[model samples]
Target chain A: MSEAVQLRRRLLLLTPLGVAAAGGVAFLAMLRGMQSGNFDPRGVPSPLVGRRIPDFSLPAQPPDGVGFGSADLLAAGRPVLVNFFASWCVPCVLEAPVLMQLKEAGVPIWGVAYKDQPDAAAQFLRANGDPYARLARDEPGRVAIDFGVYGVPESYFVDRSGIVRWRWAGGLSADTVSQELQPLLRKYA
Target chain B: MRTLLLLLLLAGPAWAVSSPSEMLPDRAQEQRAERIGEQLRCLVCQNQSIEDSEADLARDLRGIVRSRVVAGDSDRQVIAWMQARYGDFVRLDPPFRPLTWLLWSSPVLALAVGAGAVLAGRRRHAAPAPLSDAERARLADLL
Candidate 1:
């Protein structure tokens, strides 16, 4: 075959190989990003870590409109555990009973229903046995955003001084509550 | 349930009060998130943005963008924060760092090399003006 024709044929074969190589590199890049947690679904913590909670208030949901705010929970003479949940979230369902147990033990708990209909939130609480000291509705998810919540079923451990002590992103099991939460409570309890 | 649904529909008009953000803050931050998000690579989708993607990870990233804004971080700072945590892979247009210099330079380098080879081959094949006709005839007689 002529050299030019041979070169053309070789070029055709090399083009697809080059494309595949580029694709492989891109795939590896994507896999690496996932593993590193940069693209994490739960919003990452900011340098605001050691800072006090922001100031805001939500009109408490019906059956309780206690004007809950940063001070109501923080100034009440006890460290607070604020659980951000949604009636639509399944993990929240699992964590509900555990929270009820905490409530039974007299651990003060607050609920922030994220982007949920208030009536649905009320019904869920009633059916599952309300564990919240007072419920706040974040109908537009503003409060949750302000709190840096990544998704439903996140819990924040705030100390008596109103500083956020720790953040839990997923479902809270008894083990986590005992090992992680209870210790924080002991410090401020 | 039915009663709340009716209330929600009635409240639809009032949704305008909050602007149906479906997210925190408002349009300015949402638009900024989308702009920044489009530049971010979704870990799950691997090709889409957390803003454009519906994957759980993307949704999380979207929340992260809003959270950063609420935390009083600037757009550049938020992007830098993600880059630090996730590395260049999380950014669609990752900065030109030492590690990525190779990735960004290879294609252009390859094209230049290929062009050089093609030109060199052409030059090698070009006739250096043939020996004069007299020189050609004398060479033929010696053969």
Candidate 2:
């Protein structure tokens, strides 16, 4: 074979290996993103975002009180934050103070206790300092399923029009409040 | 004896992974539920099918599948209901839509690339060009 053909042959032999190396490099970059908290492996983008809120009617947590539903949100004159949390979720404990901060800002926050007993959720709210204006129990988690919630401490921002404008899959950080939530709250307001 | 004991231990966890996701009393309906459950992905345990997952969501999904089957929903309808609520991610078998076209065709692309590389790497091994008259006279003198 001529030198050009031989060189071409060698390069052709290395093409698959080159492709594999590129894939490996891309995979390592993804791992780095995960480590730096820039990417979440568990974050599945909520399909409910950019769409109307799903239909749901859960009972008042601890029984004997009025619980919020989709109609309640649609009737609201402004944006509201819908939070799905559980008493057993550790991240919810960390997030309680941030939620209280939002509550103090006069942001209307609705809480759904996901898959937890009504009594436990009521006690948890009592212990954590209740920041919710209207609280409900998603005892069967059917409401949560409808909302595409896979885990606890998920949140959604619904506009006055009942459109879910934003979704956060994990615990809300201070940055998420100031950066993501605050901007959407203003835009929709 | 040790190998037999090890096999027995392995079988224990294997059986534990899937424990009769059937809730229907009717044998055929229960089997149908089982089949449908296997196609549903557990949102919590993303890798495992609902039938194989013990996650709470998986149990709920299995129950939903069985209820749908019991209510006379076709298998397609049952799967579609889940896909509606949870989006296409709820199904283990991704549908061949625009979003998943690359994922579905990547193997064929890889196969084509591999075949091209293999074909290109083959040596031609063609016969050499004939020697000139000067090279023939030199050969004669050397002989």
Docking class of 1: incorrect
Positional deviation of residue A133's Cα in model 1 after best superposition, in angstroms: 0.9
The digit string of per-residue lDDT tens for model 1 on A97-146 reads 99999999998888888878889988888888788888888887666656
Instruction: Report the C-alpha lDDT of model 2 over A1-189, residue by residue, as the tens digit.
Output: 569869977988998899999999999999998875567765576677789998877788753398889988999888999999999999999999999999999999999999998888888888988888888888888888888888899999999999999988888989888878899988998
**Residue pairs clashing, model 2:** none
Candidate 1 lDDT over residue span B1-143, tens digit each: 99989888886453311224546657787666667777877755667666667665466677777787777788788888666444466777868879789889999999999999899779867866568898899999999
Which regions in candidate 2 have their CA more than 4 angstroms from the true location?
A1-21, A36-42, A62-64, B1-22, B122-143
In terms of lDDT, the poorest run of 10 residues in model 2 chain B is B13-22
Candidate number achieving the greatest TM-score relative to the actual structure: 2
Q: Native contacts recovered, in order, as a fraction for each?
A: 0.00, 0.42
The A-chain TM-scores of all the candidates are 0.74, 0.81
Clashes of each: 0, 0
Which DockQ value does candidate 2 get?
A: 0.45
**Per-residue C-alpha lDDT of model 2 across residues B76-117, encoded as one tens digit per residue:** 999988887778888889899999999999999999988986
Candidate with the greatest lDDT versus the true structure: 2
Cα deviation of B135 in candidate 2 (Å)? 9.4
